[model samples]
Target: MTADLGHGVPEPATTAATGGRPEGHLGAAGPAPQVVLNLARPWGEADPLDLAGAALGAGLDGVTLADSPRLFPDCLLETGRILANTGARLAGPCVLSLGLRHPATVAGALGTLAAHHPGRLLAVVGRGESSVRNEGLAVPSLRTHRESLDRLRELLDDRAPELRLLGAASGPRTIRATAARLGGVLVDVGADPAVLGKAVRLVRAERPEAEIWVFLRAVLTRTAAEADAAGRPVLGSCASRLVRAPDWYDLPAELLPRVEAVAAAHDYRRHGTPAARGGAGRSPETERLVRDRFLLTGDERRIAGQLAAVRGLGVDGVVLAGALTGVVERLNKLATAVRAGLAIDPAVRTGPAADPAAGPAVRHRPDRRGRNLSAESEE
Candidate 1:
């Protein structure tokens, strides 16, 4: 599917070449970076399960649902529906927060899901977001977060031995603690390569083998106005969650007030709407900071460059938050960008090409000399 990302930007040619496999391996790149969707607006106009199936169809690795019970749909129910509706082998959805819910309740829900779907169910818990705040509950302390994760992990083993427990970490203590305990750590710190690089180092320092996934606000366009409009809501909300502790970023003085303003003005009650979360982004400067250091918003090559930079830092995957609106097209556009270890992509086409599924026109593997020789030329 050739999706026009407005501005006449077509879907990445890599999407066609990989035959829509999210794990499209570019040789010697370790493995393709896992591209997953984290629904910033889970209960929006789109059906969550249909969105999950569409994501799987468009070469995405996984889907994670928002578990803000008071604010939206029941993530456990939605996750199970996706498992049942979508092809089990190709996908599963993670519940984004068990921080607010009791570990026993979470265990029971997941156990029931496992009994029905078995290996297709997945869970990732975090110190809750809207799920906590919207209900007037205090954000769990780091120690409380650690305890909740441990109990959930233990309970899941009895009911669903195959279930993997991944925890989310946005700060130093949580990053260290989650790494020591969970199967993987969803690093939701920031999208900046530098921050992610530091986060990657921190995760590995605690547990070398931990799976590290960074959560990013991703946009597949280069228009400054469009990117700002699309990015502000999500990024502002993220700032509110992550920018509280000044030391978390060691943020500069100039950027400090801007980020702090965004954090302060973001309202979860009006979550995921441009109007509600338009904080410091009223100016180009704040938006640029977000684009450069906190979010992904640019043309395919620029986006690819950022992805490559992050991948170079040894990140395992990326969760595209606030992506449910145009999930499939955006992911397809990002397929080539998600590649690792290589600076230039062989699959990137300069002009129109035939559909790769047609069997003749396709991307060729890079040779040992690192040359991308086409099949037509190699023979």
Candidate 2:
């Protein structure tokens, strides 16, 4: 049966109780932002079922399947299989490029998945990195991406209102589009505190209620070397993006040329591999800088401090990605650190809690940008 898409669903409110805190302040009263595991690294190296089970065992709130078919398995099928086998919510296919599939086709698929998963599914679409470059396709312009999302939302609202649509954004324009039109913005750049803080403020100014999510590479290790090695690919990816769109992020002035060099030199064929050569490969210092600036690394205490700092920025949630080697162990360590971080928040108080299994609900309303607005559901 088709679900009514026009009815206003009462999505959970972005109150201080849930992770969505008020602008400019961390809301300790709410549960920690949901920690999602990105299974991009394990897509081909590990079985999807095993990864899903590991994610559930690690107590991750959800799992995101990367949508690079050439580099990984089919995300849709893998996600469906995982959803069938485990209770871990599916967070995304995080479409790497646009124009490959018609928006309606993507919308229909997501709507069907939402119908099956209900509140457990979140649809994250964006101009992803490696997949497009590998295909020799041009990244869709910001305007085209926004329009695609707008069309996708319309289709989903007409067919399945319960399915929430979010855009992956890094710059001012995409952030504005997400605040104005989509359900939320998944900030997909390095976890630089300044960049994150600025993005959150930008979205809030446009739409105070829009959900804000940040993605970061996380590893729990005793030494900086181990952490840097584990996070290099992700860090390099961030540097590549910075180089391609220098104005998109607020990176330090001195680092721009180096970052641009990395982009210019990045070899897409060796994507996500440790040996993947890039201009950033010029020196160990560049690698270390990218790792420190882009990732959450070090021991539990240090990682906890970093997570807390991000939460303090009023972020709604965080998506953690890591290397394929010992992926489950890393996820377990990160989850433990997240719990510790949440425990330390001053705003957290002992009280009757909301359903722990329930995922964030999103609803849309008309906004000034002539786009649809999405917020945490009060349900």
Which candidate ranks first by TM-score, i.e. highest?
2
In Å, residue 317's CA in model 1 sits off its true spot by 2.8
Tell how far residue 182 is off in model 1, in angstroms. Answer: 1.5
lDDT per residue for candidate 2 within 189-240, as digits (tens), equals: 6767767667776776666556667777767777766765575455557677
What TM-scores do the predictions have? 0.76, 0.80
For candidate 1, the per-residue lDDT at 215 reads 73
Question: Of the candidates shown, which would achieve the greatest lDDT relative to the real structure?
Answer: 2
lDDT per residue as tens, model 1, 1-379: 3321122222222343432222353221334456667654535556676666555555565577766765557777777666665552323334456566788888888788767865445467787775676676787777677678778767776787555456777777777877776646778776766666677667666665555667776667756677766665565656664466556666766677776676676666656555556444465676567555667667777776766656455444566774423334566565445533224333332111222353321222211112111211110
Alpha-carbon local distance difference test for all models = 0.58, 0.62
Residue 94 lDDT, candidate 1, scale 0-100: 42
Task: Predict model 1's lDDT versus the native.
Answer: 0.58
Candidate 2, lDDT over the whole model: 0.62
